[model samples]
Target: MVYYVAHRLFSAHDRALGARVAEHLAAEAGADAVFLPFCDTDEEDLVADVKGLRLYQLDTRRLGGLTGMIALLHGPSLDDGVCMEVGYAAALGVPVTILTTDFQTYDRAGRVPAWQFPDPLIEAVAHTVVRGSTLGPRTAAANRFAAFADRNESQIDAAVCHGVDALLHAPAPVRPAPKEQRGVYIEASPYTPDSGLLAAARSSGRPAHVSRRFTAGDPLGAAVEDWNLAAASCALVADVSGPETPPGAAILIGAAAARRQRVIAYQPRPAYTHAPGREPNWRNLMIQYASDLHATTLSDVTAGLES
Candidate 1:
């Protein structure tokens, strides 16, 4: 059974999205998906008739039946209970897929994050992790659970499809990157441009791309954009600088680091910013993050990429 484990996205507040996602995944996954959308109540914590077990009994008894897990991550932080579920699923050798909305991107593609990195434990275990967004007319969470799914339906659908495919396939799940990736992928920011860095990346004689290039053909082709330059490249160059530090670059650093990818980081020097020490602690955090190949200059970064 494929366990659909989630928290804030479910609960009394956004249960509608929870139910809709549950049903949609069940339909998409056929008989392999097993979801329990039962809410905790004064009457009971929720008892599943399948094995006549209560919610608390999941870890002790039924968790052994888990083949895979799909986590819907959102809100301020991932809930403690859901984290426990992922842990249990992990102990049971159940592969996990994390679909998140909290890490919304600067670009509307929902392909990546603007900020808010996922848990390292999640990164290490989950077979796949996808960042998603509401994208269209933003809808406020209802006071009570609503009847329909929100504008995030398609994004949710895509995430579920990946999770199900991963679940059904087990050990060898489909990955974001191609088996034989081409060159280095350089990520850019919003307020500040990375054109200088882009040129530097290309000078290394490896294929490189910026966000503008990622969305060239289709204005909002984050999903339809077949090749994620980040995933396709041997390494990635992230310049986390400018007037206001872009959250996307920070979160991208985390994701890339989590994947154990060779990341070349180039940040504005301390003198470049008026606020002292390269945008305060943010740069330090990034330095510690991409310490793998933190470069002092664009030339140095390109040199590292070439080597």
Candidate 2:
């Protein structure tokens, strides 16, 4: 009966087309489709609007240009606040719709646009959404509302089975807590930005440390340090989606796999890539990747924890 919409924001500078689309969607759904307010907005003004619907604010200003590189070299993490809202959505089991067609395009590695999270913390916890632009153009405003209602009803049913309440919803993992030990290793690669995955390993109750600092010039050196850290670790969490294709955050999953350590490789969808000759048909590829990853639904990460 209730629906939430998450998006970039409403801005005075934005063209009328975007506003028309938002109005159309809000009217179509009948359910309050709240626009995620931008971080630049005054919180006092936002207090009333933020109440009924979930509110999200991301400081994309930091990502204005080449700052990710500079942050990689200097800051503890390049994407510190970037994942905040998504992480919260995952935790609360809310569905998120990314409202942009520009984001749906695949990158060089055959992966969906890098900006969209294929999979992340609280895996099946949020509904990653992408609205169809066609729906708003010709249909009666009322027909659009009916369509929104239909689409959302289907999404909620799927959320029930996902790890929406895993911490409290599911039984605990079978592994014993790690002993308080020295020399912990962390995989802090700029390519794999979902550090929340590290929390799963840390939950084993050991003193684990991840390398939050990274630099491009010393990628090999950084990998070596991670390997050493894994060597010292009782188990290494890695992703095995391969390079060249560079499976975004999944690359860390692959690196951990290469280390021959305990790893829970998060494969968003068998691996979609944009290599020269190996590329799949665009529309078909997008459909497959989204379907396979259950991109619109949240699943439980705790279910994969070793027993």
Candidate 3:
């Protein structure tokens, strides 16, 4: 009955307006909903908000600090907090309706490069693209998100358990150990320092090759294509240590793996690097993931493949 409105993190004025828009739309569609703006204020506020409705807050702005480096090493981005909120909502199957007319698309045409302007942010919204005249469909989609959320509480909790199990017993899957392929194409972010991981993977016997030298740039499109190539040829590895690897890549790989495909995760650490600083409040997501999957870290993955 209640829907969570996941809006872009912003100032009070904009957040209030976005809340009003979501409330209006949800009410018009006969669904009760509320907006939980992201903040770094205190745990009391977060605890209170999460208790009332779904929590729609960002994770961490910590990038290169200890925890941030850990996150990056594990596979998170600077914008991962927002992505985490969205992912958590989606995982809970929460009906997350994004209202964007509340803001305008700035033309940073000259100030910033054309490629950066409307791609990432625009694409995130595009996944749930709302048409101006299609309020009815948008409402329906919101309701669907709500229905998904209804089932999410239990499912998400169970997924946590699964991740933990995966990490503790990663080698239990019993799938035949993949042969040590000659050349494994690795697609990572331009800004990510994955040479260490690449070297680690190779040292373990999997020959790795990256698409480019490296720098921080968008690799969503490239990752998607590369994922498909890897899925088909069994010659690609989703080396997710790149800043450019879109959060959606995780979802895609999960989908592929669900279909009995062999998607290998070359995860090297326990944190998300893309996040900015070291915040104690930064959740230990990778550990939670390991717990949920019933396996230990991918450090066990190499042994599993060899076994």
Find the candidate with the highest lDDT and give its number.
1
TM-score of predicted structure 3: 0.38
lDDT at 150 for candidate 1? 56
Candidate lDDT scores, in order, read 0.52, 0.31, 0.33
Clashes per model (N, Cα, C within 3 A): 2, 19, 54
Q: Give the TM-score of candidate 2.
A: 0.30
Query: Global CA lDDT of candidate 1, please?
Result: 0.52
Model 3 clash number: 54
RMSD of every prediction: 13.2, 18.2, 15.2
Compose the digit string of candidate 1's lDDT tens values, residues 213-299.
333543334422212445556676877554323334443444454345677777656323122112223343323434367666888
- Models 1 onward score TM values of 0.41, 0.30, 0.38
Per-residue alpha-carbon lDDT of candidate 3 for residues 168-219, written as tens digits (9 for 90 to 100) = 2222122223333344444443345453445544655765555431222443
lDDT of 2 at 77: 20
- For model 2, residues 25-115, the per-residue Cα lDDT tens digits are 4454442422322322332344532221212112212111110110000011212112233322222323333333221322235544432
- Could you arrange the candidates by lDDT from highest to lowest? 1, 3, 2
